[model samples]
Each structure stands twice: as structure tokens, then as C-alpha cells.
Target chain A: MDTAFCPTCQVIQPTTGNVDYFRLFSLQFSFSLAVEQLEENYQSLQRQFHPDRFASRSATERRLSLEHVTRINQAYQTIRDPLLRSEYLLERLGYRVADPGQSEPQDPAFLMEVMEQREALEAVDLSAAGAAQQLGRMREETERCLEQDEAQLARLFASCLPAEAGREAVCAPELRQQIVRVNHRLRYHRRFLEALDQAEENISEQGV
Target chain B: MAYNERVLDHYENPRNVGSLDKNDPQVGTGMVGAPACGDVMKLQIRVDDQGVISEAKFKTFGCGSAIASSSLVTEWLKGKSLDEALLIKNQQVAEELALPPVKIHCSVLAEDAIKTAVADYRQKQKSMG
Candidate 1:
């Protein structure tokens, strides 16, 4: 079923069908996308589904417009954020990202790295000299890690596209494993960034 | 969401909230992470010459439940032998803390941390012997 209007009636359709977010935005199933283009698409979709336009129409049409708008907002929110977008794409391919504290045995070395980073962040004396500079450096480092993981995700996702234009895509086990690996790294990066933000908040709260 | 009294207690005044030397042959270290909540947990155990867990410590960066889970386990680790510590389960942790359904994973992480720490200790012993 089309995400927007019915083919025969040209009327807004109910959101019962499982519409992939990429299809809703008419986008290819890839991680790397133009944010500006996505913004324009989102704005246009919002205009098309604006519930106010259906105020004079049938009751079904009004309800359908509201549903479509809600779905569009959710889809846009998911695709606009890189971490969420990657997770959504993986979900589309039938991969379930492990929930917090439910992860498999991750690499010990990586966990140690994460532990050290968190420990360093925890030990920072916000009122100490050059604290702001230290926080800035940490934020930049975490952001760099996020960018690297995103770039790797883009490459991996591109490799797993369907062979033909309309064929169903099959995700090989190796690809899924790599995707999961990068997803975990992205999650860690996000956590570290949060820690950095908390440290900065601490400094400001101290009136330093 | 409001944490139960037990979870809050552990979170506010976490027990054994520190680190042990990973290089110490008598110390075993386990590091684990939950990608779902972006929580990392590091659990360490120091074994006595008699093979009993003499001391335990943890450093967790996560939600209240996670911090409490690890903190609670460190307390449990003391006075237990390595083999006995391996018997500890996430379910027990969850039940003790009265963790909400969504926060059960925090207990699972603590369980994994214990197993990993024990494994690390065993590995070091084998290499030394």
C-alpha cells in the first residue's frame, strides 16, 4: 500500500500498512543521505498531510490525515538522527539491536577503553583550571568517533543493498555482525558525549 | 521512573565503587557494556591465596539500576569463593533489587561482569601455573 494517498480514490490512506521510513521519504535504503534534501521532503510531506486541509472533507479523510501526519513526524525524527537512522535501517533488515545491559559478551579491550574514558570523565574537577578546554577536547574526540562509525555504517549499508532494483535484500551474517559491532561503538560514543555534557553542566552549575 | 528503595540505596551510596589493579595476578577484571542504554560496567575481584574472593570493586557508567546492580554484586562477591561467585545469576540480582521489567537488563549486565571477571582470573592462574 502506498504511504500517502490511495491510487484509485486519490484520498489519504490509513497508516495500517507497515511502511518503511525510507519509502515514506522516497529515499534509497542507505545511511548516507543529504540532510537538506531530507528536510525539504519532510516539509513537503507535512504540507501534503496537514489535517487542516481535510477539515471540510469526510470524517475518514480527516482521521487519515491526522494519522499520516503523526507517522511522518515519527519517520522524520528517526531518519534525521544518525544513530536512530542506522538502528531503523537495521531493524528494517530484521536485525534487533540489543537493549541496555542485555548485550552479548563485547570485546574486553573495548570495554576497558570505555571504562577508562568514563573514569577519566568522572574524575575531572570542573572547577580546576583548563577544565572547559578539557571538556571541549573530550567532546571533539567523541564526535570524531561518532563520525568514523557513521562513515563505516554508510559503507557497510551500501554493500548490502539488493542486487536488483526491486528484489528483496538479504543481509549476510557477516554484514549483520559488522553492523552490530559499529552500532555498539556508536552507542558508546553517544554515552561518552553525554558524560561530556554532564561535566560541562557541572562546571556551569558551580558558577566557575 | 522512580527507583525502588533498594536500587536507590545502591545508586546513592554504591558499595565497592572503585577499581583494583588489573595487572595483579590475584585480581580478575571483567568489562561489559549494554548498547541499549549505553552503560559500561567494569567489575574486578581479588582472590586470596586460599582461592576465596577476598575483595571486589566496580566502576559503572549507566542508569541508576545499572549502578545499583553492579554495586550490589560487589558486595555479594566478598567472602565467596571463585566457584561460588560463578553461580550468581541475574535473576537473583533482579529479584533482590525489585527492578522494573525494563531495568532487568541491568542485572543481566552485572551477571556477565561477574562471569567475565572470574574468567579473567582463571586465565591468569592458568598462565602463571
Candidate 2:
């Protein structure tokens, strides 16, 4: 069996080892991913390759079943997470992300932007009555940024991969750079929301 | 599985759970979050021009392990040089806190917070130049 091909069935098989999540499962990178549909697909795959289902099978068969199940789970997880999915896409296109220990020096412009946002967040007093409303506006702005990120991801998916044909091509360096910026912004936006949530919780507790 | 006693202690009673003034030239803030588990940690350090971390504070809205990790790092960071603080590894934190494999990432996040806080300070210095 070619590793690129879906290992579960005898359809058009791509080879394995070098296969990515996008290739392993035919999915368009979009916000339109239906949770119910995903669950259904996962359940069907579970029934097919779950190790318990193959408990009486031969050793090789059981091993294969276990491997397939792991791949399915990995695929599901990667697709379910927008950040992970973006990172995986970058990896598939041959970008080397810095290891957790290694610091990838970021662009100075991006750092300045981060510093400015952090400063803005800190300067606002969430303890004040009007601060929560201001933070709520920030949250809305962040949500809009998230939507833009999704749109950019959709564009990347549409441009990088060929429709019908499964050939993989390297994404543009410029595009990859944009993706990294968006990833960083998304990280900050998430933190901002968490901080807002904590403030709101405190406000409710104080009954003010 | 039950959390380590030390981790539980920190989680239940996190140290330095507050924010510092980001506008203050002496204060550096690092906010990081992992969307995977919906964990957010904000670490702030007051650094003098000498690059010494005089005070460290953190506020984390995460699991018990994450709280412990941040709390522990805040304690370790005070009085340390920015360089020394960045050297704090997730493994050591996890070991001291006795974090299980599943909670290792929380420790990693704390280590990241330290590095990020230092980096933020460095950026401030660079801009001041």
C-alpha cells in the first residue's frame, strides 16, 4: 500500500510516511467544517479500525488496525484545531518551526505591535466601571481579526492545493510569513479574551 | 489522577496573581495562551535598567498544573538576571512540581512565559536605544 494513499481503503492510494493531514483526509480548509459530519466520519472510522474490533485478528492485522486508528485520531485532532491545522499546513509546505527551546527571532515590527497592544491592555483599568465596556470593544475587534484569519486561511488553501489533483506544492514564502503573523496575533487575542473573562467573572462576583 | 500536592497548593493559592503597569518603563508584560487547552497565562516582571528582574508576578486562568507552574516560576524569577530566568527549563519545573506527562505542557507554558517576559523586556530596551 502506498503511504500517500488512504490506508483504510482501496481507493486512490497515496504513499505513506510523507503524507500530511490534509492529504490523509480530503478536507477543504474552511470555517464551514461541520462538527456533526466530522463526528460521523470519526465514528465510522472507529468502527472499521478500532483495535477492539480486531481483537481476534492476526498480530499484523491488529497492529495495522491500531496504527490506522492512531492516524485517524491524529487527523481529527489536527483538523479540529485551527492553529494546529495552520501549523501543520506550514510544516507540510516545509517551513521549519522553531522548537520549544529554540527562539525564532521575530520581525521587529511585529514585536513593536505586540508591545503596543500589551501596553494598551495594561493601561486600561478593568476594575473601573467603563473599562469592561472598553474591553468588550477590544474583544469584538479581536473576533473580527479571527474572521479575517479564517478568510486568509481559506485563500491559502484554495491557492496552494490543486482541486481534484492531489499534487503538493510549496506555499509562497510571503504567504507563509503572513500566516506566522496571523498566528501570533491569534495567540495574543486569545490571551486578551481570557483576561477579559477573568475580569467579568470578578465583576459579577462583586455584584457591581 | 490526583495533582501533586505542591501543584495543588499553588493552584489553590497562586502567588503574585495580579498585573503590573505596562506603561511603566520598568515593567515588562508577557501574555501567552494555548488554544488547545484554552489556557491563558500573563506574566509580568519589573526589571531595572541593569537587566535584573526585581519582581515577578503572574495571573493564570488555567488548570491546577498551569497555576502551580506559573506560581513556581514567579518565585524563581525574582532577583535573577533576565538571562538566568530564561534558562529555567520546563523539565525542572515539572520535576519539582511532580507534574505528570499530561501536565508537562503546562510547565512548558510557564517556561515560555518566563522567556516571553524577558523578551518583552529586551524589546523595550532595544526600542529605548
Candidate 1 ranges beyond 4 A from true positions: A1-3, A98-105, A163-165
Candidate 1 local Cα displacement, residue A148, angstroms: 0.7
The digit string of per-residue lDDT tens for model 2 on B1-129 reads: 798899889888888878788777788777765444545678899997687888889877667898899999999999999889888999999999999877887888888788778888888878988
lDDT of 1 by residue, A63-166 (tens): 99998899899999999888899898888788767444434648778877888888788777888988999889889888999999999999998898763445
Number of the predicted model whose lDDT against the real structure is largest? 1
Instruction: Flag regions of model 2 displaced more than 4 Å.
Output: A1-143, A180-208, B32-40, B47-53, B81-87, B119-129
Winning model by DockQ: 1
lDDT of 2 by residue, A1-208 (tens): 2452256863322125644554445554433465676777777777766779768867866777777788889988977877676667666667644333334334445444544555576677766778778777877886887677777776765566455535655567777777665655555556656766776677677765
Question: In Å, what is the interface RMSD of model 1?
Answer: 2.2
DockQ of each candidate, alpha-carbon based: 0.72, 0.10
lDDT of 1 at B81: 95
The candidate 1 chain A region of ten consecutive residues with least summed lDDT is A96-105
> What are the root-mean-square deviations of the candidates from the true structure over C-alphas?
1.8, 7.1
Q: What is candidate 1's DockQ?
A: 0.72
- The DockQ assigned to candidate 2 is 0.10
